[model samples]
Target: MANAQLFKSMQQSQPLPAALARNAEGTPAYALTPRHQLAQYAATGCLNATFYASAEAQLATVLELCKAVEPSFIAQTAVYCRERGYMKDMPALLVAVLAGQGAAEFAPAFQRVINNGKMLRNFVQIMRSGAVGRKSLGSRPKKLVQAWLNSASEQALLAAAVGNSPSLADVVKMVHPKPKDAWRAAFFAWLIGREYIAADLPPVLAAFETYKLDPAQTIPDVPFQMLTALPLGAQDWAQIARQGGWQMVRMNLNTFARHGVYAIEGMPELIAARLRDPASIAQARVFPYQLMSAYMAAGENVPTVIRDALEQALETSLLNVPRIAGKVVVCPDVSGSMSSPVSGFRGSATSNVRCIDVAALVAAAMLRKNPDAMVLPFEHSVVTCRLDAHDSVMENAARLAAIGGGGTSCSAPLLRMNSKQELADLVIYVSDNESWIDAKRSGATATLGQWNVFKQRNPQARLVCIDISPHATTQAMEREDILNIGGFSDDVFKIIAAFAAGQLDPEHWVGEIAAIDIAAGC
Candidate 1:
């Protein structure tokens, strides 16, 4: 009776039962939801003392706190923070988390430090890895050195240079006392032991001109050592398209779109050709849905021609798709809170894209993968869709988005499924997983309760939760039959395939996905 009432109270968003209320730290026990705790970390530069059961347990909690955001969001926020100059520590924290998790790559952290002047210590530590900082030095090894001289006062530059690589004394001897000559002298000093000579000075000088206009906004694609510099006009973009192909275009699509240069005439055909090309097609086959999701989320007003070409490319690719012998139910949460912008994209302008938009797209993609699957969107209520295999992902997304937003009730789908006697073999919910059920009201079973009720009828049913935001811990994931995965990448579905096959469990699920890039030579 006590347990029943505790579950009932959860429906109204009241506190959990005292026994389950607090974690070892005496903090509210919500899975992964650290909104308030994160704020405390930001202010104190340390996690609260009560987050862990004991001093021994505090270490793991600190690591968990570091990895509070999805991986893709970590990359996005790193770029976003540098561009807009917001939460600089977010990048550092992400790097620290990934490092703690045994990830060796720190290229993103290195670039974040060099370009934005944040996370310098982290960058320095990561640079000790041979592969970390080399890519961001920007063709000319002297670009950062020049920027430092131009942007910093003489004393500031000298102070920064005091920690000797070859030694600050050598750099000071090579540099001029005047700030005007400081950049040229610093550039000369950087080149002293390096390849090339004074003959290469012209291109470096030209690159430095653009660098001075905006030291922080340098494009990663352009090399500092190139003999001539060209504005990122149609000609340069065309050359890039010809040489690097669709993959390159995919990487730079957001950047070009932000710069208003993605829609250059004749470019769509080039992109289409690249998508259709056999080599490019093979690469797509390796990561079909992932490539598609990245391309789709790249910009607004994506040309239909490109979308159609991608559809063809996806159909032709031999990407992994595990066939299940049972019916599948995809539940996408379209609750009111899901309408909020994900990551740092908060404000009215970027509000057009929301967590629900991502969830709906993922559901649509899953529907495409499973021809016999059905989608039932749940908010305060459940709505069924009469979807056809012919509908494009965006069309399905539009239909789901049109369902609009209301209060959250994650259990509604399970309850409705029970009522309809149409339990599924597999049920996947793409949601924020913040369910509020009121036991005081009629028809109120918490999600777990509904799942248990549904299982009595369909013992084989399994639950896979795709968390759009990793801000909170999930209740569904506590069970062996339930799997929780996060991130916006379509490659996550491949992980789902592995999980469904019984080849992976929650413990090794993430480890497997993280190994794919290096494993596949991607």
Candidate 2:
């Protein structure tokens, strides 16, 4: 019983390698190790996968002894016991599929580990030359292996992976070794045929080539509105609604009196009599986030480069005026992998709220451009506060709520940002880019350039990526250097941080696709 199926595949772990815990601890690890016969073949014990007479001769005897094993039981099994073939290891499955587990649930044990393929093509060129996720990357592949290398099936490869439109060569053979599947005919001749960040992605996701002999009981659950639908044009759909945004200045007041009353008074024929019967549009978009937070007023020329990115984020706030320094961590993301539901309000009781929190309550008014700033709350990670750093991160995120939700973690609050870097050492992460930072970092180096960890342990730090979904107008026409912060109005987020600081070249304007009604609203 080959050591009781190697101890029933190391106590039912399924994904096992590092030479079955360094050759069952006799100190024989993975990757071409001197490993003395992998500690007498993982201490024999009588191999287990429940006495494999079948699971296809126990995964073809773990991929024919992981293709003539040696580099110590081929990296010593783990990705669910080397994708069920008992752990054909390659330096412990290349440090567990470059730590992001590339395509887990035993990604077809990436087919006997690509039999000598540049460790799955240099782990997709070190996560597509982005150099692994940046708030200092080290957070394991928590973001579903960076959403399987930014998906792509078609919609013109999710509109050229978000530079908006262009992906064909028959949708680049469904996301092959990718660079939008090798510039699909120079991005479908640069989309002269509209391409909104298309996405269908499923071509052997993270390469596996197939052969371990039947074990894939089926998987591939990818639906976040099909990779956040990316197509736009006609002057970038009127600058995503001339940046005044939110469905291009969405104002519906059949009765806006607010904090005083009238709250959608009868609510658009009570939402056309509850959408002609039942009851829920989240109770009819809860009177449009309460009349868009009571007709949100305040905007006078917020330009001087967004008053210098709110005075360089209020001179890295050690706090001043209205009592200085510390506390503003509003981390609310009710997980269970965020089960989407929210549509339009007050009903049978439900709210998966993520319409991009109307751009996180309009970027938490950038903590009134900084003063005591705090909003503490989180999911999948950070959620514990005894309430002190002098209170008020919006009065302790109004005792922030969380019934529970899962899957979302970015290095679980590295000891609360290294024990509060003197009043928030600049962290302005706002998601909906569908989080991703597939791990790896040690003596860092790799740049699109944005460095600043000064006392944070630099990896070219300066960081800031605020993509409020609708794929930030296809990642601002496809990354000339990534800044994408389009409008939800505080005068369209101070002209989207001065059109993301090229000082604003909104190309004299004319774009809005509020779900197309006949066409172009002047």
**Candidate 2 versus the native: TM-score?**
0.19
lDDT of 2 by residue, 10-48 (tens): 554432222212111122222222221222122111122
Q: After superposition, how far is residue 285 of candidate 1 from its true place, in Å?
A: 11
Q: Which ten residues in a row have the lowest lDDT in candidate 2?
A: 508-517
Q: Report the C-alpha lDDT of model 1 over 1-522, residue by residue, as the tens digit.
A: 369767654653543222133222222323533432332222212111221122223334434554664544334333433332233344454444444343434344334434422234333333333322232323222333344445644333323433333343343333332335545444444434433234434343445445556644443333222312535655554554555535556555555455444467877776766676667766433344344455557566556666676666655542444455588888999877777554324233332456677677777777777878888898877976667757876667768866767776777888898889886788889876666642222222366667777776777777887765533345453456777665554445766777676667555334443232321211
Q: How many backbone clashes does candidate 1 have?
A: 12
Against the correct fold, how does model 1 do in TM-score?
Answer: 0.58
Give the clash count for each candidate: 12, 90
Give Cα distance to truth, residue 135, candidate 2, Å: 24
Local error of candidate 2 at residue 252 (angstroms): 20
What is candidate 1's CA lDDT for residue 395? 69
The CA lDDT at 379 in model 2 is 47
